[model samples]
Structure formats: structure tokens, C-alpha cells
Target: MWPQEVLALSRRWLLVTLRERLNLLFSVLQPAVWLVFFAGAMGGAVDSRVVGTGDYIAFAVPGVIAFTVVGNGVTAAMPLLFDKETGYLDKLLSMPIRRSSLIVSRFVFQTVMNAAQVLVILLVALALGVRPASGAAGMLVILVATGLLTLALTAAAMALACAVPSHGTFFAITGFASLPLLFMSNAFVPLSAMPGWMEAVARVNPLTHAIEAMRLLVLHGWSGGVPASLGVLVLAASLLLVLGSWQFARQTAERIA
Candidate 1:
């Protein structure tokens, strides 16, 4: 029953997203532009020696993939905010469906959307000469890592959506939080290049682990760090899912009451 409900909800959300053609284009375009323009300009100016790769684009591709997940994942709450504004959320909560399915379905949809965006970024990267050393296997690992990261971010977004009363407040909060998380991580630069204190923070950032793991997979094939990276992502995803589920339950209960 739960599986069916989740799937149905996810399908509905997916269709809504697909119907937004401009949004879909822009979602893909944002990362593609970064890959082509930003990466292109920086890839040429930066010495490969500093980045620890002969091709700076290759080094940056994984980071861009990580960035894509983070960028898209953070917006997972917008749908809920829209629903709430339109009174759709209250209507849905009034239904007999499993309340937890609301959270799960959003997570599932965002995970798939993030994966699609990552694929588009990777394809653009490949066209620009970025090649993963691990080949097909490495691609699979990248997908898994990105999916887990997306799931974690989506869960957090859903929790914030439930807790916040307005879309403006939610976007402000998420934007404030996401930028620091992205810049501090190994998304655009290596940890070694950062200041001592910043490097310390990056060491513990979940995004760092995800980026590092992806770097190892794409640039050098599977390494010892792969298991630890994936493990952290999986654990974070599980914990955030629970948190979001709890928030959804609470919010729904209040509405129903």
C-alpha cells in the first residue's frame, strides 16, 4: 500500500515538473553553462599542476556533478511551498493516503531530477574532453553518490518547507546555507588550496566527502575512500529522511486537527 501510494505521488510530481518546459530547460542550462563557460575559462587559466590533473576540465567535472546535485536538491521544497499556497497540501493531507508518502514522494522525485541534471552536466563535460578513468563503473558510482546526496538535500528541503510559513523565507534560508556549503567544499577548488581554517571546515563537510569520492572514482578509479564516502552519504540520507518524515507527519497532523 505504501509503495503504491509513494509511486503514484511521485508520478504526479514528475509530471508536474515535466510540464514546466522552461524550468526543465533552465535546470539543464544552468549547469551546462557552468560546464562550458566557467569551467572552460578556468580550465584554461589554471595550471593543471595546481589542480593535480593534466586536464582541469576533468578535475572540475566531478565537482560540477556534485554542484548540480546540491543546486537542484535544495529546491525540492518549492513544490510543497506551492502546494501549501494553493491549499493543495491541506487537501492532500485530508485524504486517507499515508502521510509519510508525501515526504517520500518528494524525495524520490527530486532524486530522479537531480540524477537527470547530473547526467546532462556529465554529457556536456564529456563533450569538452572530461573522461572518467573508471569508465562505466565510475559512472555508476557517481550516480549513486549524487543520488544519495540529492536524497539528503531533498529531505532537508522538505523539512524546511514543512517548518517555514512562506516561500520567501525558505528560499532565503536555503540560499544562505547552500552557498557556503558549496564554496567550502571541493566543488571548485581542492582543499589543499584553501586557508587552514577553511580546509578544516571542508574536511568535515558532507559535500567534501561526496566530491572527494567522486573525484577518486572519475579521476583515478575506485579507491579506499569510496566506501567511506558512500557510507557517509547513505547515513546522511537516512537521517535526513527521518527528520523530514517527522516534520511532514507533524505538519499534517496539525492541519488535520
Candidate 2:
């Protein structure tokens, strides 16, 4: 990959994200809002032991972070679709830069943006009387897991962007997929609390592994499950990165041809 081109494009997109102040504010706030309200509503009703945390807020914090990654990472391709519509993508295609740089830059931009959002959510969680049981070291593990999950989601979204004919269709597909994935995971509750079938689904869900990893860190410190969860994320991210890169390269070639 062309590192310079990737960095340049990543920086350009980051600036655009910053310029859209309202969108940026909402992106950060939405997760925080969900963490606060969702936790408050469920805290008293749900048993803390069932949720696998001291309180619902603590349990929901990682869930909120994971969902934020889903929300932002899945829409990471919107700008690419806009570029395609405006002929900017064609211009980039005509340039000497590596085609993979486009995908890399998108990954970089989404990862950074999600990181910032996660930071806000963590601060909000802290204010709500949550603390990471494993301290700063566990917090770092949470970030790493979150980053891998972001990479996988963003890569898959960009691959879909290349596959779909329009941005509207992309939105439709991702919108349909995100919420179901959230509900199927052990994000808000422990797997033991889920129905048999949903529990089975959650067992295999990549998002579940990521959230569980974060939950383990936040509520229980390091555990044996952390490696397995991180492994799942790493595998998913690697495979999706390859798929996305290939899809983008093929699309570029076809457009050029």
C-alpha cells in the first residue's frame, strides 16, 4: 500500500469529519445518551448478577461502545459512495496512487473516529459510577478489542459499498443488519440470561466476543476468555480486510477497463 497516499486521504477525511461539527457531536453523544438512559431504564429492573456486572450501567457501557462501532463503522462507506456519485472516485482511479490506499484510508479514518467516540463513552461510564476492574491495563485491552471490531466492520461495509449499486441500498442493508446483530449478542446481558437459540447465536457472534472481552476487562479484569475473544476479532478483521481490498481493487479495475 502507498502509505503517504493513505495518510493523506485519511487526514482529508478526518478534517471533513471535524468540519461536520453537528454530526461529530451527535456521533459522540448518541452512544453516551444510550449508555445513560438505557442503563437507567434497565438498572433497577434487571438483576446485576444476570447482567454480569455490578450494575446495569457498567454492563451497558461496553455494549454502547460496541454499538457505536457498529453504527459508525457500518456507515464508513458513505463518503466513498458520495465520491463515486460525484466522479471524485473516478478521478482517484485515474491517479497513480495504489487502489488499496482508498480502503486503508477509510479503515484508518473509521478506527480513529470510533476510538474518539469510545473515549467519550468511557468517560460517561466513569461518571455513572463505573470503573474498570483491571484498571488501565484492562482499558487498553478493551481499546484493542474495540479497534479490531471496528476494522472488521468497516472492511465489511466498504466491501458492501463496492458490491452495491447505490448508497441508499447500502444504508438499507446495513440498517437491517446492525440492530439484529446487536440483539443477538451478549452485549446488554449475559449469555446465560438469553434463550437457548439466542444464546447459541451469541456464542458465535463476533460482536459478542468483542463485548464479552470488554465486559471481562471492565467487570472482572483479565481472564482466559480474553485471548479467545481477541482471536475471533483478529481473524474476522484480517479476513474482511482481505475481502474488502480485493473487492475495491476489482471494482477499480472494472471501472478503469
Q: lDDT of each model, Cα atoms only?
A: 0.84, 0.86
Score candidate 2 by lDDT: 0.86
User: Taking the tens digit of each residue's C-alpha lDDT, what string does model 1 give over 98-167?
Assistant: 8888878887888777777778878887887778888987888898988888888888888888899898
Which pairs of residues have clashing backbones in candidate 1? none
Best by lDDT: 2
Clashes of each: 0, 0
Candidate 2: the clashing residue pairs are none
Q: Cα lDDT for residue 122, model 1? A: 80
Off by over 4 Å in 2: none
